[model samples]
Target: MKRLYRALLWLFPPGYRLAFGDEMTAVFEALARDRRRRGKAVYLEFLLTESITLIAGAVLEWIEKAAGREYPADVAAARRAETDVSVPAEIIEARQRVTTLVSLMTDAISRYDYKRARFYSLAEERERRRLRALETGQA
Candidate 1:
């Protein structure tokens, strides 16, 4: 059960998992142990409810992150500055373009639209090259 819970934790975004994985796991384990003392049925119900909630929460977190709303604007800006305070605007834009292209390509592939996927793949390659150039100060 602990292993399965750990696997579910992987569904969360990396930053979120890094920030709270151990604490969340510890709490879950303690709750599981307490629930088990009641009965198998009760423990199972708790597990089912928590598992579903975790999955839904992970999806919401990903959506929020993609929408650039995971953190409050001021905090988000501070985090970005801490990570890449010296990164130039052009480089950042280029990187974002590359990331967008990759996401589009993945969506196309998941929908089984090979042609659209190919187009996105080509665009992603071009964007990646642009990003590389910008990073190297050649653009």
Candidate 2:
């Protein structure tokens, strides 16, 4: 079932999959794990529902991409927040630093390098705090 779920993820467009595939898979796995604890019938039901929804979502995403539609505001914000030109130079630099740390943390976790992941995680937290301070004119 897990294998099937992973395979279905390929229905999404390559760019969409690249941006969100791991997160979607991790969420589905966690939900599957939780549903499995409820019993076989419930788990099966969850699997069917999730699979159908995922396929539909993938199709819709592909259609949107093919049509060249704008991204939803939240997604656009997330993508744009890193490079928003209207923000101060210091804020943009801080955001870039945080983005780099987050990328490093993700890479470390993927490699099972927990020590480096932990270091990056801590750095991210500190940077986030600093960013908040900057936003509030406290830095």
Instruction: Pick the TM-score winner.
Output: 1
Tens-digit lDDT track of model 2 for 45-65: 999899899899976775565
How much RMSD separates candidate 2 from the native structure? Answer: 11.8
Itemize residue pairs with steric clashes in candidate 1: none
Model 1 over residues 1-139: C-alpha lDDT tens digits? 8889887875665456656678899999999999999999999899999999999998776666565665454345535643685888777676566656756766777689999989987987787678667866887
Full-model lDDT for every candidate: 0.74, 0.75
Candidate 2 stretches greater than 4 Å from native: 70-139
Evaluate model 1: give its lDDT. Answer: 0.74
Give candidate 1's error at residue 26 in angstroms.
0.4
TM-score of each: 0.54, 0.49
